[model samples]
Target: MYTLLSGLWKYMFQKDEYCVLILGLDNAGKTTFLEQTKTKFSRNYKGMNLSKITTTVGLNIGTIDVGSARLMFWDLGGQEELQSLWDKYYAESHGVIYVIDSTDEERLSESKIAFEKMITSEVLEGVPLLVLANKQDIETCLSVGDIKTAFSDCAPKIGKRDCLVQPCSALTGNGFRLSTEWLEWLLTVLGSNGISCVM
Candidate 1:
């Protein structure tokens, strides 16, 4: 009877949660992306001033529930020194949302190196990666195709993980539609894999 009751309770009210890691190089718009996500999804969320968003020193975390699923996002500092600590959270991450400054052509190579390193980490094996070519509203922003082409060689090195590249603008919210699509995709993956979003 105890087992039966427990099963019934879960069947009636079970929530799926997922841990998402947001990574990128310094000034890559990681924090802004996170804040935008929260503002867009959370209930009655009062948003911060985007222009006031500063570089993260350690981490910023937020949670949002979509249907029966809850997404826990970890926005980590992108400084060169802070990057060494990224591996610490890899084992627990269900997915990765890598933000890139699409308008910053000068740092493309540097960003690629950082991206390659993160996706190639043994701890990140098989984790789904959603690459956001952020700041797309900017005049000089790279197209999603161009960004993909730049990372073409290194992308294949990401193992068997599922990946997607989409354009976004964390500041203007011009590309938030992609964020919705991404969450739906993530939910489908989590369901098929029987992954629990408990962490």
Candidate 2:
């Protein structure tokens, strides 16, 4: 009976929860990425068709349980009009996943500006960041290093935040495993910092 009681206690009281925000410019595949994540982690999750995905006008939310932690992702719209509302979620987010379209070289400068602005926000100071240079399957796509260099201006502004830039093809599920890698790192960071994961 002691083992049963201990299991019950852990199930009831030892859940770790975290909030994550997904942001990027319009048509950068934010919604598709969210759907892919849900499908990847959820056993019975029946989300929208990947090929039919479209621009997210407002927000898309998803939750997944890995180990003892429950991660809640708030995928905010990336349109120019919706970008201003991103700060509303920053204060609550434990980390951020900023997506970039590596295949769209013409918009690299624009994305860089947006990234710099987000990282510089006071509310998001010290928040860990995962920058996904998506669309790696495209032959003409920019490399992960190039994407990182483009956002190099935001380095100083990152300050205490942990940051990583990884290449991914959300459409083809390439490099998706990196998501789990980052989540593990995030847990370690929270533990070392004594940060509460309840939110």
- Tell me the number of clashing residue pairs for each predicted model: 1, 0
- Please provide, for model 2 over 1-199, each residue's C-alpha lDDT reduced to its tens digit, 9 standing for 90 to 100: 9999998988787778788899999878777888888988888999888899888888889998887777889999888888999999988888899999999999989888888889989988877888888888899999988887787777888897777777788888777564677667767765565544674
lDDT of model 2, residue 75:
93
lDDT of 1 by residue, 125-148 (tens): 888888899999998789999999
lDDT scores in order: 0.87, 0.83
Question: Can you list the residue pairs that collide in candidate 1?
Answer: 17-197
Q: Cα-based RMSD of the predictions, in order?
A: 1.8, 3.1
Q: Count residue pairs with overlapping backbones in model 2.
A: 0
Q: What C-alpha lDDT, on a 0 to 100 scale, does residue 17 get in candidate 2?
A: 79
TM-score for predicted model 1 compared with the true structure = 0.92
Deviation in Å, model 1, residue 10 alpha carbon: 3.8
TM-scores for the candidates: 0.92, 0.89
Query: Total backbone clashes of model 1?
Result: 1
